[model samples]
Target: MTVALTTPMLLAAGPAHALLPNRSCGTVTSADSTAAANLNKVLTGKLRGSMTAYRLSCARAIADATRARGLPNQAAVIAITTAIVESVLENNPNKIDQTSVGLFQQLDHWGSYEQRLDPAWSTNAFLNEMVTLYPNNSWQNQQIGVVCQRVQRSAYPSRYQPEVADAQRIFNALTAPAPASKVHLEIVGADGGMWNTDGDYAAGEWSGSWASLGGTGLKALASAVTGNTMHVYAVGSTGRVFTKDANYSTGQWSTDWAEVPGNIQGATALTASVTGNKVHLEVIGADGAMWNTDGDYAAGEWSGSWASLGGTGLKALASAVTGNTMHVYAVGSTGRVFTKDANYSTGQWSTDWAEVPGNIQGATALTASVTGNKVHLEVIGADGAMWNTDGDYAAGEWTGSWASLGGTGLKALASAVTGNTMHVYAVGSTGRVYTKDANYSTGQWSTDWAEIPGNGAGATALTASTTP
Candidate 1:
């Protein structure tokens, strides 16, 4: 049978004021010795010292999580009680175990070890299990012993009451919540459009009727951080640079693509690091030189007019924003990456070009961030090999010489880096999308190629979704 925890399980034991006083658990009022002993057995060495801190942290976390689910304060109590009775605030150590690992003492055999050890993961698993066992949630009253007897069917079912009281106290004392990490992710879908979400794999499909656009409709997907929305400016098929937005919120798409001042072609979209709501759009001008327009906006309207960024060439890739400045690198026919940018306030373009060491141009996928102000660029070399360079863009120095990550199959490459984790995805000639993800925690990229879901061969495009 699928066991679960339900709403009723969260009901306060006794009077709310009498049972738990103030914001603190009052006077160590445990239920009974029997319940206490069972709790002691499970809790063991775990719940010593900092009782106040422990109780506050756990209680707050439980409350925060339940609040999102529209649950009341009592459910938090239930989660706390269960956690206290199980691992006593100490998570299970990392090691192969016959039983599931974690604060819930889960056995590794149940699932992957990596997931089992994650605190949030363990909490989620326990909550799911609770949902399964106590579908009606009337289980809490059996006292800890009777309730545990119904679910765990422990060898010693009689020892539930004592443990329950301790669990309750721990549940009450530790009630502070964990802090949330704020981020902004801008997702560009296949249709020359952009949206925002904090999830991975943003979803949208080509809704076009034209057969020539082929089943080959665009999916210009991209993701950045979380929270902030994307600024998009593109040259439409009509020979006009049409702009729109799908950043945060819902219901309707932005209407009317605005026309830019100059006669342009091959326009690419990018955001500025130092300026808020500023988009730097680069395109090949009528003279075949690279020209750009910089405009700032908020709430989906342009506040600044399109301005000129003097340069030349078809080789331009937007640098990830850093502080108040953003770098745009370009390559001419010789196949080398070049750089230029303006500070946050003036929004002026640099006068001269600086070449990156080694012949590095033509169809490149790049990613960057503020941490150390670093940049990573990959390109399909003349020999059809994949070469990468990593270094500080502002300093114009390569940290290390160019390294060949792999060969041949690097077409349509897209890269994203968050914290220390770097992920690169590309379509292989063999008709499969290949992936390389670096785990920041371990400081290493995974050695195998992970295939994306629902995509195989046949001209696939790779974009990372950093929302959910």
Candidate 2:
């Protein structure tokens, strides 16, 4: 029953174990950007203290651990409060009491030194014992000090209670509700500046006039709303990808356009989608391959530099997310539509660009409008007319056929679903913006493309973000 795990065997096997807690933080791979941001703001406001980034990261680690365990905010608050008192919100760098360690200062009885030192393992072990003692979530009704004392058996249980107010404040600030969910349409105006407009898509009304975000030499654009902020990305004509964030709740954007790390030279198309905590951004880079990156919007950083999702001769691209699965669609060299997927939950992808079975070949460009588990894929047909197909994420099936939306010369496409309706925005060859709607319940497309009251034209790209 005991097989030795040799160096090679252990090296290969350990990553899966390591990644388990790392990925399960609220169905996200769990980036700590928001936690870091919240800590900075709170530390500066009323809890004025010199907290190091390392200590802050430890608190974030506990937050991620609590989320991974599928626990409530109260659990996080209690656990974090305990850590705040026990080890001052950090896994002790130097062991104390000869056997106690980690954020919670877990003792030898908790687990091995290695386990006790891991913020995630110690947090979980504490919870496991806490749950055993307080079955049926009886801990939910108990006082924060009582729960912490029961779990830690601390000598000074009163010490934990005094910290609950700060702990609750930190958790509240970090888990504050995301900005009001609305669709932010960022597009390339005729003058090449980045223009944006917000609409209560769920109500079918624009909130304000389009404002210029001020850019030059930009080519393709992609956008998504994550937390309380809107992230807009664009590739300059020179092929450098740049990004900026507009925190709607704060009513401010990042002071400048920060360049996204990575060269996506000759990017012909750009698309952005939000999945869990990270924003998945990919572009058709030079040599006709898809180069992808994930942005940690809260942390304000880009990771995975440029991972190439090698499909050659790809044309325009579009992506949509349902739950943790991201569906990326692209037009192939032969005019056939192909798609692939990335499951954030399992960190895996479809083996290849599988041909969609609708025989809807000869497609040039496409956009995926996701409502519930359904993806309403709208594409420009070979004849430059609008066509559509549907895919169900829950069932892993696509509609057996493509239907004509009965339009021609549709040049650009972007769609946002609010409530049960899919609002499709397209640009015609005449350089006019038009919108049509599909009511999910009635299964009906609007009678005609109603031109919006805008003379705005000459847009090369469009992207709309709604609540995930």
Candidate 3:
């Protein structure tokens, strides 16, 4: 699945509104024993005072509130610290003083009893006032405790100081790298069945079983992830383009395939890229030329007829969209890689394809991804070893010599980029899946390949994309 920019995908739990066990004298305890016990029970371990269970929920509430209000992480930290100092990260519905309640311990002046109990609503209320008090991210440079005191104006202003360390701990844990929710794999079976994993590869199981879409003429398949929907394109045996959409949000797929108006020929290759709401589909046409069409899924309509990209001898196709530029790559009949540059902003494509500087003429399959201005290409060499090349899109040139990502019996390839990390997936001739991870920030790929447990024998095509 090729990733398109959209909303953040993460599992969210609803707020727990029960009150924390009350403390005497209105002095907030270092840790709520009952809350800690409940958290440990949920986590199956004793991580005292960390508020492990509530951390993610409360953090998400703070994040959503700040984003909606255009506030910064600094403001989020201030709110978190205030909540930690007041209720130890517990949603205390009972008033500690005169009608104070919820995570931030806001009084009746903040809102109604029910409003104060709603974690998300209370978070928004707190951030709204905090931003009003310290506009333009001015609170970022101040001490966190001081910022919290300024926002809360608590009777004991110094009380928030001791909770700073715990607040920072919770914040860091919440902001740490989340597990990928949208690691998707689409494969064309030898029987022409379209098989797909339900974007749950991170859980070590590709959905208990692969879903068979029951298509008989699919030659090559490609998919793109935009928001909560996965758009799939496959080449029919008769050289026609067919598309189907799967809504991850609803766990449903279009009941039937929709024919895309395109005249493709022979054994076709399919690849897609997304620019904003527009999805561009590229295919190796029957006439050996490249054909392209686009649609705005948001508007629920296709744009125009398929336009010939005017290229020949293209065998395998792959594409990536970086900002306003779309990079389409293909393996020529002679085995060398050729690329066409399309500028969406200018509504123009390069008149001719440029040869990438590498000896990849005999490659059987290839995949590509874009990170920032750099495009990374990996190909299964004629010798069955994986070879890679990096292109500088801004500089309009290939940057380095072809490097070997050593492997043998490789039969298929797919790749996805997350942040500065690129994950490459491949299937070996023995029907085993393997992965090679590279960090673009550190300029290195894993020296060895890790094999996936399950066998993937007889897969004709493999494609991958990450969810937003």
Best-matching candidate per lDDT: 2
Q: Model 2 off-target regions past 4 Å?
A: 1-181, 202-204
Candidate with more favorable, higher lDDT: 1 or 3: 3
Q: Residue-wise lDDT of candidate 3 within 1-468, one digit each (tens)? A: 998969988889999887555322122332333343444444321124355434446555665566677766666777777887787666776876888888788998989988887777888888777667778767677888887888788989987767666555555555554434456777777678787764454454455456677677688888887777888888888878888888877879898988876444563887899888889888888788888899888898886588889777778888988779899988888888888979999989999998888666688788999888889999888888899999887787786578888999898788987667888888777755678989999999999998644444567777887774
* Candidate 2: C-alpha lDDT: 0.77
By summed lDDT, the worst window of 10 consecutive residues in model 1 runs over: 207-216
Candidate 1, backbone clash total? 57
Where does the lowest 10-residue lDDT sum fall in candidate 2?
19-28
Runs of candidate 3 with Cα error greater than 4 angstroms are 1-181, 198-208, 263-267, 394-397, 430-432
Higher-scoring candidate on TM-score, 1 or 3: 3
Please list the C-alpha lDDT of all candidates, in the order they appear: 0.49, 0.77, 0.76
Candidate 1: global Cα-lDDT? 0.49
Error of 2 at 27 (Å): 31
